[model samples]
Target chain A: MMGQTAPMREAAKHAILILGALIVIIPFYVMVSYSLKSPREIESNTGGFFGAQAPMVDEYCVKVGNPKEDCLETPVIFNYSQAIKKAPLFRYLLNGVIVTASIFLLQVLIALPCAYALSKLRFWGREFVFSLVMFCLLIPVHAIALPIYIMLAKIGLTNTYASLVIPWTISVFGIFLMRQFFMTVPDDLIDAARMDGMSEFSIVWKVMLPTAIPALLAFAIFSVVAHWNDYFWPRIVITGDRDLYTPPLGLREFQGDADGSMWGPMMATATIIVTPLLVVFMLAQRRFIEGITLTGMK
Target chain B: MAVSSKNTGFWFVAPAVSLMFLLLIAPVLVAAFLSFTDYSLGNQGFSWVGLENYIKMFSRSTYSKMISASVTYVLLVVPLSIGLGLGAALLINSVRHFGDFYKTIYFLPVMAALLAMAIVWEFTLHPTIGLVNETLADGCGAWTETVFSFGWIPGIDGGQSWYSKGCQDSFPLWFGDKSYSMGTVAFIGIWQAFGFNMVLYLAGLTSVPRELYQAAEMDGAYRAWDRFRLVTWPMLGPTTVFVVTITTIRSFQVFDTVEAITHGGPSKSTYVMMYAIYEKGIQQNLMGIGSAITLVFLVFVLLLTLVQRYFVERKVHYA
Candidate 1:
């Protein structure tokens, strides 16, 4: 009896899952669609998926005293070019790369050594320091945003790029994850390095770092995706300095006073901001999923 | 173990220890200390008002509403997202085809920046020209309207149904209406969040031993629900706990959607605690009350985490 109804049950499950998937895809569809659409299409809610590639006049361009022919361009070109022209989007993407890269590299520098010590090296007060790590993991850094912002403000470090990157330099979860991974490394490998006259510090860089690449790659994905997508810290620290804005902060600034005519460019900006990570994730779905779900393993 | 290597650990851990102290430990202590005094930026002096800010938090309606809004958000987002996540996970796990396709689509939200997606969602939910209303309005006087209106059931007059009423006039201004703002923000929150939880639950589902299911079958658990209750839920114990704790914390820190979409508006109906901290502490520079709220927020988080820890110890057992 169960076998008889199994196909029907499975089809029902698929139907339900399809409905949920459609809901998930709506905003993404809107974002990409709006990016390709003319302002009229957006306001009227017309253009089916991609707007008609109609060569519409950009009133803003015309209002700037340009030629009518010069202002005449397709909505796709107008939206994307206006997005770049309206804001230094390239600079924001560059800052995003620099910040996420620096944070990840610095995290590895700090976490790898500490995790190595905790997992491999025998030292005084090791257990206690490890306990401190466990405790700090419970303290969400965002919760402490009030005090940190106050401290940064008092030191007049609020507007600097340093302020954005400094607070996230020490990642306790990174330390914990690396430590767990390091514990599984055979002690014979470290002893072998020591026998080969490599110093402990050299061993960390030369031997341990190379072997920990897979874990490091996973951690890199986790860290970069997080900081890249992070809006909260950058919002607080990079106040009013449009030059220092990360991608999300830049998008927020773009939308701050955006009127109706700017929807096309605004979503173009969003699509630009969201595209890099989405592209990377698509290219490496397995690694990205494994890297992100690494949190769940803890 | 080499006793000579003992010195390496201290030097190895030094930078991380110092950083952890300066960045993590110090801010928490600073938040605690600042909660008692009226401090502001560029102010030379501060006078301690012991428990005054805390008193204000408990006594004031605004702060009270902030607490309720946050609790309501967590109460709504946590369970719904987790249930949706678990359901999606179970369904996707059981299905034989297109599993990866659905997984990728669901996780798109988790990868995209929340602020950007929230903006897109704002556009999608716009009152007049938005896709939501446009699509809903299309169903008016159509078969979807009658069926969705529940007009077929006896005594279920079509006029009284929300679907019918929406068809009659319009849907609520999703993020603009006071009654609906919190729900809409929570909906966006769930949209961005459940995918992560689903991925986590999917990971958990994989670790459930196949032999246990076979054993359950041997025990005459022929029905799907019976097999699931016997095998799946118990094996997913640790994942469920972790998912709940993480989702709760994530839900508590929900500021991007509020900041971008609502700005805690519709008469502060969506005034969550994180936004409250930002409004008071940073923007308004009311450091005392902000710190007080921050402290209260920390206490709630730590308490929730502690409860999860306790429950995990007592209830979650691996057989």
Candidate 2:
């Protein structure tokens, strides 16, 4: 009786695990199924839980506004083509890449020195400045959006990419993350570098940067994802210029025009927009997860 | 640790600080000034109005509603997401096989891209032709239609096509309705956010010592609830506090989901304070009113964070 009960209990545990796993997997299944369904099938609501039909790109093309062409036959449908045709997705993507990369690059350039200063350099206001940066992290971006908008307008920088990119270049979160990572860098290493007559910048570039690769990569993933996924800043800064729209902003524009009605095309467009981030996340899952975990630890 | 005569550190920080000052700090000061004036975006200049915007905001009923909605959203989303995260973590931690796979699956939403998820969710929750309704129909036995037809629930019809002509007036538009809009937004918010919190919880849970559980079992407190209560809950205090604090802040700052899902629509039922500020300042170009709203939101968030810190820090167990 005892043996039977134990096996039953183990089976029950497995059942619960499967149930939990299903909850995580179901939405993704729905997203993929909906993306692959024909417009008529989607409209008819014929696709059941797992989708009745196999994945096809023709429906994806029709939804992306290419009625004349069917991409189902091709090995790769170039779904991004349909996406670009509908919106300046490529240009927007380019802008996003530039803005996000620039922000990350500038953050590294600034944060490495500041972090080194705080961790290595003995200064009077060092602790106070570090504390101030931490306090700034508490201030939500929205809290200062209005003020930032006015400041940019005054400088004749409104509607420019500078308005979007420059203001967000120095992230308090990035500074904090780097500082935490820098604190973990051994003091002995810095002492050795100094003993070798290396300047502070040289130490940071040569001795510290290579040692800080994991932290930098971790911070890079965080910075890229945050800025790339950002919509609020671009919405306010890049007004009335479709050419300047980022991916998130572009998706918003498409949704606004479609207005909660066009599911097929909207899903296709969404799939296009999401694929890059998903690809990036998959490629850098380790760093991304580590970055998030490290942030939480702090 | 001695201060060297070298000024390279100053130079390194100068560029960043100067940029931050020019872009972030300078704007905040201008915004503070603008809050006291009657400045609109289109207006060439501003006249000092001396707290008129603040006074106006206080007097408006809509602003009060917005404050309540934002508070409710934050309150509901923070604890719930954290709880869900903890649950997911516990489950994921127990996996003896394919542990990494489970982690990846749970983390999918976090990496899936928010705009895409929001759009997908919007369709999934569509009143008609949505997979949710179809699922409900299959599992719940057409209860929505029955409820609507039997007059069990007012303003909710199940049988009528949710998207077809002549159905717009009869069918319940989940996002388009004022009474249910915030609730809908909160549900989506929870769905999108729970995964991130789950990861944090998992990290915390993994760090818990297994010997405690073994000792609890030895003490004859081996029931699931008993084990969790006597060992896991106490050990997880710090992580819980951290999760709650961050989740609270995030909930207050929620913009992407709102923008993607509702745009604070259906008569501004979903209009949280941030959205209100954005609409007034950016879209409507009422810089003064927008600035006033932003200041109000800032004070509100600051107070909440302080109170939370005080409360949570007291409960956080280092061990």
- Candidate 2 chain B, run of 10 with poorest lDDT: B161-170
lDDT of each: 0.92, 0.74
Candidate 2 regions exceeding 4 Å error are A1-27, A47-81, A259-262, B1-6, B138-172, B311-315
Candidate 1 chain B lowest-lDDT run of ten: B1-10
Model no. 2, DockQ: 0.52
Off by over 4 Å in 1: none
Candidate 2 residue lDDT tens string, B1-319 = 4357236656666765676666556666777788899888667777999989988988887787778879889988987777777876786776556666766767777776676677777777677766665555544334544443444556654445333322334344568677778887887678778878988887888778989999999999968899999899988888777788788877888787777788887777788887888888888888889888887877777887787678776866747
Restricting to chain A, the TM-score for each candidate equals 0.97, 0.83
Give per-model TM-scores: 0.98, 0.87
